[model samples]
Target: MKIALLSYSTKPRGGVVHTLALAEALAAAGEDVTVWTLGRGGDSGFFRPVDPAVRQEIVPFPDVRGEAVGPRILRSIDTLRAAFDPAGYDVVHAQDCISANAVSRCVRTVHHVDHFTTPELIACHERAIREPFAHVCVSAAVADELRQGWGIRADVIPNGVDSQRFELAAQDVPGLSRWRSRLGRYVLSVGGIEPRKGTLDLLEAFALLRKSEPEMRLVIAGGETLFDYRDYRTRFDARAAELGVEPVVLGPVHHDELPTLVAAASVFAFPSNKEGFGLAAMEALAAGVPVVTRDLPVLREVFGTVARFATEPAGFAAQLRAACADPGSRQAAGRDLAAGYSWDRAAARHVVLYRGLLG
Candidate 1:
């Protein structure tokens, strides 16, 4: 089957990572898959490198503007492109909320919701999630939010990672010792510097933890934020300096190197206020690193009994301390849980969904 994916902002973030993994998996399973996106920096920065098998077609358009032409009109233009060229593909999958609204009726459609927290985005998403396209939610919590808040029914398909790549290595790298020495032995947090991700809360928790475990260090990995919030990285660094604790900030590590980063951690710290599905937490679990996340429904569902849940920063710090104290049991439990998921299994499920939609 020939499939086309519509990605409005296909950047190197969680959602884009999920999309590419799924696309690659689908191609490996013998489906011809291609990605249609507004090229680099057109809408949102397109940072991810595309797979060789998965074709990428950048839509021909200038930089997106303010509400002068309006988003609806821009969406209509994207829809026109799909409608005009409906010859090659049997199905079109839209990975973006707004872009899904414009797919042609000739092609079977699928829409995956990575995360939808705002009411305005939800309302806009509702228009795209019509009868022809099957709606897929990254987590049950996300699905419930769509139903309860937006009344949009969707199939729950958790976001998947390439487990093999993230698996624990038999031998550690020669440079790992130096890397760890520089990073220190504290809890690790990896994600963009954003307020919604609870980076500030993580720093606060780390500060609280340092009082007891003075040697503990908190390492953050990711780039600076575009949105004006608390300047999470800055705030975190300042707080660490104020407390006289070691805080390591390693800007965005490569996808291939993520396993090393996770494996080196004493414990993986995720204090996000919300998530569609905690992909980073899953990666940590896949790497046999125990997780400490907020008591959110999506995270609870993903981690199950394999992680430590905390509601506040103090509790988070306590959990981190406990997790660090018992690394062997935590790693063992995480490894066992991660064994349940593989890229091939996730690919097979996507194939089934696509075939069912065609039938």
Candidate 2:
């Protein structure tokens, strides 16, 4: 069977990563897989290379003249892509809203719902893409949101971590020696620096936590998101300084190095107000590190009974403290939960879904 995946931007975002992983998994199971997307900055003018087995094509959509490109440009590219690649694959999987709106049927499309907020966005989404034959939500909560808000039902397919890439050792060993000496027992949060990611809330919780746990540090991984990166960075840096919470913001570490960073942490703190699925928390759990997240439905669904959930900032701070105190309990629980989550299993699920669609 041959499968084609469509998305607007195939950059190294979480959704893109998920698509690439699924494509690789499908290809590994003897399906011919092809990915289609637009060209991005600093990348080769071809399919964003993943597995050698997977084929990719990039439709160039460059912003011409000194003017900014918006919906018109995207629509042009989408029109061209849809017209050119209509009958090549057995199933066409569209990741986000952009790709979903562009392609029409007899392509068995899978639209992944990462988040469902804003009625305007929903209306635009419906107007843009043809209703998919099937939709996949990373968590049950996400599926429920689509059902409740948009009147769309979707299948629940939790994001799976590559356990081999995120295994833990006997102890928390800092792989990077330079930062290892300075960075001691800290709570780790990995995501783009954005308010929706709850970076500000995490900082607030950490400020309160530092009053009791003075020696504790907060290690933040990844760079800025949609907002003004410069302003957000300055404000966050200043807040940390003011609170005297030793904040280490390492901008965008390589995905390969994430496991070591996660394993080195005492606890993984994810105070995200929004999430399609808590991949970082799952990764931390996979690395045998305890996780403390907010009372979000998706987090609850993904972590189940293994993670500590807090209703408020105070509660979150307390949970973090408790998690830090008896790290072994969380580690044991995490190891147990992490056992079932693997990219192999996730890939196999994709293979089944694709085969079923083909049949």
Candidate 3:
């Protein structure tokens, strides 16, 4: 069957990552798969190279300087809608709010639900959830949220991690040495200084953690998003200054270098206020790095006993300290958990769902 998977951007956001990986896996399983995404910021392809077997349809979405996010989002919907013809595919799956809103009919994947204040965005989010014929959630907790909030039932399909890639990175002594030489004894966070990412919370946690581990650095990587977080960034910078802590903000690390970066971390901190499945944390786990995540049900469901769970700054600081000092069997347990999430299994489940929908 011909399958079309749509996402808002060609960046390395969790949802986009899920789309690309799922498409490749489906293609590998002898199914015709295509991934459609908006090539934002002069990008002609994904952040990383995709499998040759899966077709790519990157709709040109040039940047508009000084444009408000609301207007830009609406324009993005209009532009993608104009370019994408849904009639050609047997299964049309929309991966995010923008793509879901633009398409006439789709199987929407509610990776994580968000609350929007703007009227247009609120409406768009509502329509995307309500209009989609079928829905998928990466965690059962997210599916439960969909059911409780909108009375919408969704299929729960967890994300698949590239366990081998990160596992190999852990074993790459030279690669690990390079990253460790660059940033020594660092507590790492992936997902930038956005409000949803709980960046200020991380700042506070890092400052507190520094009290004990004075020489440890706070290293943050990856901040590619369609949303403008300048205001939140301003707040984050101010808080970092107030707390007398400086962090190494390496925005958007290269795809090939990311696994090594993950492997080199002393401890991984993911104090996100919200998340779908905590994919970045999982990648760190796969790399044999100890991970501490925000105490969210979805993350709890995904990580189980493999990850240390925390809520606020103090909690996060405490967990990070424990993770760094003594990871124990959690590291091995984490590797096992990460390896269990296979893209092949996820793709086969998707095929079953798609066929069920077609029938």
**Candidate with maximal lDDT:** 3
* CA deviation > 4 Å runs, candidate 3: none
Estimate TM-scores for all models.
0.82, 0.84, 0.99
Residue-level lDDT tens digits of model 1 in 1-359:
99886655444566567777788888888889887765433543345566689877766445444433245445544554654365778877776554565564522223224344556555555566553357777778777876786576777766666555667431366435655777767587877657677887787788888888888777888653323444555786677678676667777777556677777788999998878777788878877778999998888888888999998889998998888888767676777677666666777876788789889
Residue 265 lDDT in model 1? 82
* Clash pairs detected, candidate 1: 186-217
Find the 10 residues in a row with the least total lDDT in model 1. 106-115
- On TM-score, the leading prediction is 3
**Order of candidates by lDDT, top first?**
3, 2, 1
Please report, in order, the local distance difference test score of every candidate based on alpha carbons: 0.69, 0.70, 0.92
Clashing pairs for model 2 are 101-128, 101-129
Q: Candidates sorted by TM-score, descending order? A: 3, 2, 1
Residue-wise C-alpha lDDT for candidate 2, range 1-359, written one tens digit per residue: 77787766545566676778877877887889887776544344432348889887766655444432344445544554555475867788777666666676523223234343556455546644337777777777877877886676666666767665677432435473434566877888888667667887788898888878888888988752322456666787788788766678787766556677778888899998888787778778887888999998778888889999986788989999899888888676787687677666776776677677677
Q: Count residue pairs with overlapping backbones in model 2.
A: 2
Candidate 2 lDDT for residue 231: 69
Q: Candidate 3 residues 1-359, lDDT tens each?
A: 99999999988888888999999999999999999989998889999999999999999999998998889999999999999999879999999999998899899999899988988889888999999999999999999999999899999988999999999999999999999898999999998889899888989988999999999999999898878899999988988888899899999999999999999999999998889888999999999999999999889889988899899899999998988789665888999999999999999999999999999
